[model samples]
Each structure stands twice: as C-alpha cells, then as structure tokens.
Target chain A: MPINSKIVRRIGDLARIDLSITDVDMFSEQLGEIVDLMNQLDGVDTSSVQEMDSEIGNGHENRPKDIVNEGNCIELILKNAPETKEGFFTVKKVIE
Target chain B: MSDLASLTISKARDLLSTGEVSALELTEHYLQRIESSRNLNTFCFTATELALEKAKSCDRLMSSTDRGKLCGIPLAVKDIFCTQSLPTQAASKILEGFVPPYESTVTERLWKENAVLLGKLNMDEFAMGSSNETSVYGPAINPWQDPNEATPLSPGGSSGGSAAAVAADLCLAALGTDTGGSIRQPAAFNGVVGIKPTYGRCSRWGIIAFASSLDQAGPITKTVRDSAILLEIISGHDKKDSTSVRCEVPNFEAALNGDIRGKKIGIPKEYRIDDTPAEIIKLWEIGINQLSDSGAEIVDVSLPHTKYSLPTYYVLAPAEASSNLARYDGVKYGYRATLKDDEGINELYKRTRSEGFGDEVKRRIMVGTYVLSAGFYEAYYQKALKVRSLIKRDFREVFSKGVSAILTPTTPSPAFPLGSKNKKSPVEMYLNDIFTVPANLAGLPAVSIPTGITEKGLPLGLQIIGPAWEEANVLNIAHRLEKDSNFRIKPKQWWTS
Candidate 1:
C-alpha cells in the first residue's frame, strides 16, 4: 500500500505533530519506502502463530496490591511542570 | 593521574582496596579526562561537584567493611536514564531542561554500590537513530578515525556517547540502553564490550520510555569482565517494574571461568546475508574458530524468521513509541512552545510537539500513528505481533536443541563516517540493527565482545546470545572470546591538546 501525502498529513495530525507541506512531501516518499519494507511480512504465513504481546512471560500478576505506595511530594511532582497554580498543573483552558 | 583513567573497574577496585589510590584521586583523573576531551561531544552534562562529593563519601567509607561493589568508580550514563535533580533529557529538544525528580532503578542500584556519577552522556534523540547525528547536542564524534578519510566516523548509537567515552578512556564504563541495537552496535563500533541483559533483567523505572516492551539497559565498558561486574550489580527484580522478573541475581563475574568446553554453540545460517562486508564475515569466521578451538561444538542452525525481525521491529517499536511519547503534551514537563493569544489547547499541543521533536522522532511518530490507526492496525500492528512470535519461537527452538548460545557478527559493517548516511532513505540506516534486533525480539541475553579490527584499523565485534535470563552463560562465552581475541587496540587521543 503506497502512503500518500494526504495520509502522511493525517498521521502527523493523529500524532499531534504539526507537519509542514515539505514534511508531508518527504514523509510520503520515506514512509512509502518503509511500508514497502514492512510489506515483506505478508510473505510469511502467520496463520497459526499467536500474537506475542510481551517478551517477558509474567503478566501484571507481579503487580503489588492496588494501593497508594507513593505520594505527598506535590512539590517534587510539580517541579518540572511548565505551568502550575495552587498545587495543580495549569494547562491551556479547555472549557470556554 | 592521566594513566589512572585507563584502569578498568576491576583494577581500580584492587587499588582502592589497598589504599594505593583514593576515590577522590580516581574521580579527579576521569574529570580531567572528560574536561580535556570535550571535542568528542560525548557528554551533554557533567556532574562535576556531585562526582567529587560521591568520591569523598567513598573515600570516607574506605575504612568501613560495608563498602559496595562499585565504590568510587566514576561512570557516566546515557542521558535516557533519569537522574534526580540532574538534567535527564533523552538527547532530544522535546525534553530540554527536564530534570527527572527520581533516579532510574539501574542508576539507583549503581549508586547503592557507591558508583560515582561522572555526568550524562549524549545519545540519539529519544534513542531513535542508529547514528548519533539525531542528538540535540549534535553528533558525539567517534574517537576512532580512519586515517585515509577526512570525515569523522560515528561511534554508533543510541548509546554512541557511552561507547565513545569508554573507548576514549573518559570514564571506566557507562550505562546504555538497547532498544534495537543501541548498546551492542555502538560498543562494536567503538571497540568496547557491551551486554544487553535479558529484557527484564534491569528495571525500567525512571528511564525515559521509547518502546516499552523492547527497551533494556546494559553497560558499555572497556573489558568483558567490567561489563559482567556492572551487570551483576544492576540486575535484580524490581517491584516497581512488573516486567522485572523475580530471578536470582548471580555473581556474573565469578561465572567467567573461561571454560566453554563441551558447550554447544550454534551459528545461525540465515545471518550470512549477501550484502555483509567481507571483513565482517572474516571476523565472524575467526570468532567461530576461536569458540570451536575452546572445545565448544559449532553447529549450523536456521532462524528463518530472521529477515522479518527488522520490519517487525520498525512497526512495533514505533507503535509503542507513539503511545509512550503521548505524555509530552506541552502541559506537565519539558519544553512547551510559546502560544499565540487565540491559540487553543490542541494548537498548543501540536505546536509544542512539532517545534520540539527532531526530524527522525517526528518521522517515527508519524509512522507509528499511521500503523496503529483504525484502518491499518490489523494489517501492520497485528501482523507484526504474529511475526514477533515466530521470531521468538525460532530462538526458543534453537535453545531447546542443546545449543548453549548463538554466535554472530554484532554489525554488518564497522562505524561509518558521520553524515555519510543517506538522508533520503531511512531504511538504509535501519539496516544497521539487522543482526542485533533478533535477540531483543526474543528478550535474550546478548553480549558484543570486541574481537577484531578491520583493514582500516576500525574495530569489529562478534556477538554471543544466550537464552532468556542466562546472562551468565552469555558473559562466560564473551569472556573466553575476549581473552582469545586479545583486542587491545584503542583510538589515539586526537581530541586532547
């Protein structure tokens, strides 16, 4: 499947990255080539194979009980924030 | 003091135990070397005061019987690992000025063993690129130079700085993360030893996420024994990381008895790709002979799904990266673009991400998002997952056949000159990870030991990969090969005045 500039633009938007016209043109070509590379997978018949979700054998069974093990360091959590107000992360207003 | 920089962790430990050299003295020597070799661009940030303070503490603890394994060893880390209060930008502009509040489990363990932090090393932005060219700090130039070529070579990445620092003797060893061939490939290119332990061997807590399932942390060092020591210290179960297995942390260094007698070593026939450079093939043949000479039976095995590994990796890694990177939405931390008066939150997100991420990172995000889109998810993501199963099964089958480990070339070619990679085609660069990616897909223990040099005096490495959680087996074989190869060549200190 050939990836067109239109599709590349949509992917950029889905990823929340603003792409320029030049970026769309370039990614269309580069991603097309990469898709061609990925197309090689179609040759192998994986009809009987199960999806490998993770390399490790164990699942979330190893997770500790659902409890708040860590907290109370509001200052540390907010230290790297771009904007903060009164112990809360401040972002651009979402509601009018 | 200058010569002290060349000492390995093992040697320095002996000297420190005897009070022949103080920890502060050793740390000062490495600090001086790091200062002098700034032209290599290996370090993005230097924690000079922190290192001196840690060294002083180690010196004070010299009288105590409860000293840790890596006490007073001055080491740097790939900027991907979060270090509290220190800049932990994963060498990307998106994470500029982002100091992590917590240290990564691996680094925390290292500090528990009293390892001193030299600073944070440069790497490919988000650990995305094969060459260090994608780094926000610019390319960390390879200390190894081709005499005939005027262009500087790549140290290979995303652990480029870790390998370069170890190669240049700027530090004893450095921590590096391997997502695809990040650690081993760079170590091969820089004539150093690096081992990516089993996927869950080290906890991923506090490390910047790239591909959640694929990333594993390891050490880049001057010797195989040094890597073994560091791996033992860093490997253990972490409840913080559910994927971190509840396995025994063996004394990896003690397992290096150099006895591979009667061990069955498999040579996967499919790795002999047609485009592989002749030097790499020659070195691989040499490696096979060395292992066989040590009484290990060399047998030919097949991994038919080997060709599919790289494509599967490209699809799946990006899919996970797209999801993992969504946290950087210009709200909480890192770089946030200045917004216009009328710009909405969505616009802020798009602008910040667009302005912050590099070309390669954006390319990956685009690819990942497209693959996981509703229309293409089944075709790309699901298919890649099934192929991943086959790849894992291939390794499992080979291991079940009494084959203790698999030996292959760590890379198809030695380090190429910086900026020589074709910008138009990204797949060409992705090919560098071909030989090393299969092990990661299987979550196996693999080590790259510097075994030979190319005709141009550049280093080449032979890899030994063992079954999952068998890091000791992998390191033992690597130690045998390291001793037999006697690869002691180091790049000249051209950057020093």
Candidate 2:
C-alpha cells in the first residue's frame, strides 16, 4: 500500500520527528519503493521452507538462571550528567 | 617517544612490563598528540587526568606483581560503552548528562586486565551511521592522507572514534561495538584491524543497544595480535547479559598461533555486488592470494539470499531497538521532559522522545514500530525473520561443506567524505551496509583487516567471516594477512598535524 499523507503524519507524530513537507513527500516516495521491493517476496515459493526465528536454536523458550541484581553502583553511573533530579535525568518541557 | 604513538598494544605491554617506559609517560605522549591534533576529533572526551590516575594505578599493580597481559596499556573505550568516570552519552542528546553508575562489562574487563583507560571515543549517535558525520559531537576525520581528497574523510561509524583513535595513535587500541559493520567498516577506513566476534561471545551488559540481536563489542587496534590479546580479556559470559553464551571461552591468544596450513577458506560469490569498485575486487583477490600462499585452500561459495540482508537487518535491528529503547520514556530514567499544567502522560512522552532522539534514531524506531505492530508483524517482521534463516542456512551449508571461513569486503566502498550524505537520501547511505549486515543477521563472527589503500589513499579492508565461535580462525587469518601484507601505513600528520 502506498503511504498517503495521513499515514506519513501518523508515523511522523509517533516517531516525534519533525519532518518538513519536503521530507514527507520524499519519504512517501521512498516508502512506496520499499513496499514495492517487499512485494517481490510474494513470488518466492516457500512451500517447503519452514519459518524460523533464529538460525541458531530457539533458546528463548528455555529460561536461564535468575540473577536480577547484576547492575553496578547507581551513584557512579549518574556522576557526569548535565542535569538530573532525584536519580532521573531532566530535560526541556516537551509539551504545553 | 616519536614512535610511541605507532606502537601496538603487544609492543607497549612488553616495553611497559620491562620498565623500559613508564605508563604515565606513555599516557602523556598520546595526550600531547591528541591535544595537538584537534582536527582528528578522534576522542569525544579525553580524560587526561583520569587516564594518568589509571596509568599510575596500573603502574602500582605492575610493581606489585599483579600484572596481566594489558598492564599499563592505554586504550580508549567507545563512548557507546559506559565508563564509570567519563560521560557515556552514546553520541546522542537523549543520553546527555547520563553517566552509568557502573562500568560496562567489557570496560570492566579491560580495567581488570590493567588496560589503562585513555578516554571515551566519539561515534555515530547510537551506532547508526556509515560515516562518523552522524555523531552529535562532529565527524571524526580519517587520519589517512590524500592530497586528491582535500576534504575531511569520514572514519566509518558507529565506532569511528575507536578506529580513528587507534589509527591516529591517540590510543594503542580501543573497544568498539559492531551492529552491522560499525567496527569493521571504521577499521577498514582507518587502515586498522577490528574484529566482531561471533554473537554471544562478548557480553553486552552496558553497551548501548542499537540492535540487541546484532550488537557485539569488539576490539579495534593497529594489528590483529593486539586485537586478539584485547579480545582475550573482553570475551566471556556475563550473567547480566542473558544472550551471552556460557560455553568455555577459548584462549584467543593461543589460537592466534595455530597453524592454518590445511584450512579451507571460502570466497563468497554474492559479496561482489553490482558496481563493486575494481580496487575492492582487487583487494579481495589479493586476500585470496595471501591465504592461498599461507597454505589455505580457497573454494568459491555462494550465499544465495545475500541480497535480502539489508532489508532483513533494517527490520530486525530496528524492531529490537524499538523494544530496547522503550525504557527511555520520561518517567523511569534518562531524558524526562518536564510536564506542563495541561500536558498528559502521552503528550509528555511524545515531547520527551521528540526532543531526545536524533533524526536517524527516530526514523529507525518508527520503522521498527511499524514492522512489529500487531497487524504488520506477520507480513513484515515474520517474513524478514524467515529470510534471515535462509541467509544463515546458506552459511551453515557452505561451512559444513568444509569451508572454514568466508572472505568478503567489509564495505562496497572505502570511507566516504565526512558530509557526503548531506544531499543523499537516507536509503542511499543505508545501502552501504549491504556487504556487512549479512554476518550480523546470521550471528557469525567477522573481522575487518586492512589489506591495501585506494589511489585516493583511503585504506581498504578485507572481511573474514567465520561460523559460530570461530573468532580464533578469523583472527588467525587476519593476523597472517597483516604479517604478510606490505601495508605498513599510519595516520596522516593531521593526526600529529
């Protein structure tokens, strides 16, 4: 499906990127090209090829030993910040 | 002391161990060189006093007989990896002022080995660019001299800082993360040696995740032996990183000395894409010649699904990154946007993220979110995952057919100009990773070794890829190539100029 302005606006807003009108038009064209390229995959015969997540084994199913508190010193980690408040970084107010 | 900057970590350690040179003196020499070469921009933050202190501490350890392989050796940690005392911004504004309370596992390992911390090197924001120009700080200039190429050249990203630092002698060697070709591409551009070990070999506890599935921290150094020694110190299992394998880590130092007399090396047919430069093709041929001369048999192999690598990588890496970066919302940790009287949580998040992430990073997150969205998952992400398996299967089949390793170019082209993409579309730049992304998708080990230079004087790299946990083979061959090749090149005087 071609990316219309509505989809472009949704993606731009969701991504929080400030895209100019020029970028929107360019990106629309690019997205169309990408979708067209992806459509080529439709021709491949995957009747015998079983879908797999990883080339390696599916290690995600088997959980490893639980050891949650492996993080390092909190004080040293926050030492070189430009701004922080109560262990959290502070930035310019993003919304009204 | 003039040649002090050019000495490899192996040579530096030998000299430092014998008390022929003090660690403080060595650190001062590089610090002075860095101060003079402001054009290189190799370092994002040069912690001179901290480096001296670390060197002094290593000196004490050396005097007390607790010296390890890297004792008193100064090395830079790529800014993407957290360092306890230095800024760990990962070259992005969102991470500004964010320093980790603890060092990354890899950085800690380097410290444990008594490798003196030089400082944090610059990189593309979140390890994203092919050229180092995407860095928040500025592009790191290629230290190679080329009168024809008067403009500053990019030391390839996202590990451009580490590669440039090593190339310019700011540090004997440095650590860099490879998600796609970050380490290898920069290593090639800077005319150095870099290795991205097989996935799961190195722990990724604190390296900022660009794409978790593809990210592996590796060493960028002047020679393959130095890379091996550094890898020996850094590659191992860390419980904090669950993806790290618990298998016994081989002694890469010892493996480097192994005989390659009867090794079967495969040259991948697919890596030679259309419009591949004649120089890069020549570099690959020279690499084949070198390996054949070293008593290794060469065979032509094919990775049939190679063309699908860039698209698959774009999907998978962004999908993983989108999930990984979700933690950076305004509330729990870094980059919280101050809420106004009327703004809701959603608005705050949108504002915070908008202000925090760079353009490329945001684009990736959007791409990732789109592909992984519930409705599109089956069509985009799942199919990409399936194609990923076919790509990996191609490698497994060829490797099982008795090919020990695959040879390819780390990039289709050498280092582009620092601002080459100012006018080029983003996809044009993304296509540069086409050659290097396949190994990442397959989770195999690969190395970039400086083979030769273009007539323009930019260094070219020969990529050696191996099966899972075959870093030993990769490093051995790269070492042999470096030993035999007449490429005794160094950074331009701009490094000292």
Clashing pairs in 2: A76-B101, A77-B99, A77-B100, A77-B101, A81-B97, A82-B97, B493-B497
RMSD of 2: 3.0
Task: Please write out the lDDT profile of model 1 over residues B390-443, one tens digit for every residue.
Answer: 999999999999999999999999999998989999999999999999998888
The alpha-carbon deviation from the true structure for residue B142 of candidate 1, after best TM-score superposition, in angstroms, is: 0.7
**Candidate 1 chain B — worst ten consecutive residues by lDDT sum?**
B1-10
Q: What is the lDDT of residue B28 in candidate 2?
A: 86
| Most accurate candidate by TM-score | 1
Instruction: Please list the residue runs of candidate 1 whose C-alpha ends up more than 4 Å from where it truly belongs after superposition.
Output: A56-63
Clash counts per candidate, in order, are 0, 7
Query: What are the runs in model 2 whose C-alpha is more than 4 Å off?
Result: A13-23, A33-43, A58-63, A70-96, B336-340, B422-424, B495-497
Give the per-residue lDDT of model 2 (tens digit) for B399-465. 9999989989888888887676743367777777888888888888899999898987779999899
lDDT of each: 0.92, 0.80
